[model samples]
Target: MHEMSLCENILQTLQQQANAQQYSKVKTIWLEIGELAGVEADALRFSFDSVMQDSIADQARLEIIDIAGQAYCSHCAKNVPIQQRYDACPECGHFPLQIVAGDQMRIKQLEVE
Candidate 1:
């Protein structure tokens, strides 16, 4: 699954941050995952443990913050919640929606020592 690769990238980022910030260990990671990012949280959690083995972030706690998908509906001129890409606007049933948020995955905070 792509979550494995995503976890690997996360490890790489953590390693880089550790070096740059001079932190020896990571205790926790707060991750913001948007619903529209297409990432499975369970898969990511499994992959993270596997990928972080023997690394600085080994056994680190992963705190996931789920972000709701949102889009701007031109027909209704309001921002509405969405579950998937190309979803019809909930308010006006418009086909084309301008995505406003919930399409990103990022590290929000890290507890390190």
Candidate 2:
């Protein structure tokens, strides 16, 4: 799955951060993954160790925080929680709600040496 490549990207980012921040080792990493970000947490976890092997983050603990999807419903004139991309607004049955959040994945925190 693409989760392998995603892990690679995370490793690359960790390397870049280690260089910039002068950290020699990474003990933990906390990631914020939005529901709509299309990342499978289990798959990413499976790939993390191999991707981080021999890197500064080797054996690092990975923590994923799940973020709920949210969107603004023009018809309802309010924000609502969404599970899928095309979900209708919960209150007004509005189609195609404007996404307000939960479509991104990012590193939230790091514990480094």
Candidate 3:
């Protein structure tokens, strides 16, 4: 899956940060993965272990925070939570809502020494 590549990219970024900051080792990585980000957490975690083998991030602990999908309905003028995309507005049953949240895959924090 694409999670492997994503993990590789994250490791690369972390390596750069560590080298720049002169950190000895990474301890933990806190991540926020939105529901609409289309990333599978378990798959990503597995990929992380696979890709980090023998690397600087091999012992890094991964903490994932899952965020619910949200959308702003133009017709209803309110924010609504959704389980999936293509779900209509909860207030007014409309399609093509402007998504307000839950479309991000970002690193929130890092624990390093």
Candidate 4:
């Protein structure tokens, strides 16, 4: 799964931050993941534990914050919440709403020692 690679990248980032901030351990990781990011949270959690084994973030608690997707509907001339990429505008039932947010995955906060 791509979540394995994503965890690897997270580990790499943690290692780099550890060096820069002079922290020795990571206690908790708070991740902000958008609904449209296409990442499976369960898969990511499993991969994180495997990837962080014996590393600075070993045994770290992971907290995932889900972000709702947002889109602008040209037909309705308003912004609306969306669950999927191809969701139609709720007000006007227009196809292909322009995405305005909820397409990112990032580390929001970290508790380190």
Candidate 5:
């Protein structure tokens, strides 16, 4: 799965941050994942634990925070929760809404020791 590659990226970034800050070991990692980002949380969690073996982050705790999808409806002139893109706005029942949030996968924080 791509989560392996994702974990690799996280590890690489963690290494950089740890080295930059002169930290020897990582204790926890906070991941912010968007609901519409299309990344599977369970798969990423499993992959994170599996890929961290024998590494500095081997014993690190993984915390995933899910972000809600949001959009601004032009027709309704209001922000609303979006379940899917290109779908009608729930409140306005209108299409062509501007996506304000969601579709983002980022590292929010890293706790090291």
Candidate 6:
């Protein structure tokens, strides 16, 4: 799954942050994952343990925050919630929605020592 690669990226970010912030170990990672990002949470969790083995973040707790997908509909002229890409606007049933939020994954916070 792509989650494995995503975990690798996360590990790289952790390593870079550890070096920049002078932290030796990571205790926890707060990840904000958007629903529209198309990432499976269970896959990410499983991949995290494997990717973190023998690393500074080994055994670190992963705290995931699920972000709801949001978009703006020009036809309706209002913001609406969406579950997937290309979802029809709920208010107006229109295409070509302007995405406002979601569809991204990012590290929000880290607890390190």
Looking at candidate 5, the ten consecutive residues that score lowest on lDDT are 83-92
Each model's RMSD to truth, in Å?
0.8, 0.9, 1.2, 1.3, 1.4, 0.7
Native-referenced Cα lDDT, model 6: 0.94
After aligning candidate 3 to the native by TM-score, how far in Å is the CA of 62 from where it should be?
0.7
lDDT of 5 at 23: 92
**Candidate topping TM-score:** 6
Better of 2 and 6 by lDDT: 6
Q: Which model, 2 or 3, shows the larger lDDT?
A: 2
lDDT of 2 at 90: 87
Candidate 3 on 5-99: residue-level lDDT in tens?
A: 88988999999988899896878999999999989999999898878878888878999999899999989888999878778998789998888
Error of 1 at 112 (Å): 0.3
Worst window of 10 by summed lDDT in candidate 2:
83-92
What's the number of clashes in each of the models? 0, 0, 0, 0, 0, 0
Distance from true location, Cα of 101 in model 5, Å: 1.7
> What's the candidate order when arranged by decreasing TM-score?
6, 1, 2, 3, 4, 5
lDDT of 6 by residue, 8-93 (tens): 99999999988899999999999999989999999999899999999999999999999999999998888999999789998779
TM-score of each: 0.96, 0.95, 0.92, 0.91, 0.89, 0.97
* Candidate 4: clashing pairs of residues: none
Report the C-alpha lDDT of model 2 over 59-111, residue by residue, as the tens digit.
Answer: 99999999999999998888999988789998889898999888988999999
> Judged by lDDT relative to the true structure, which candidate is superior, 3 or 5?
3
Q: Largest lDDT belongs to which candidate?
A: 6
Residue 96 in candidate 4, Cα distance off native in Å: 2.5
Task: Return the clash pairs for model 6, or none.
Answer: none
Pairs that collide in candidate 1 are none
Task: Check candidate 5 and list the clashing pairs.
Answer: none
What is the Å distance of residue 113 in model 5 from its true position? Answer: 0.9
- Give the residue spans of candidate 2 off by over 4 A: none
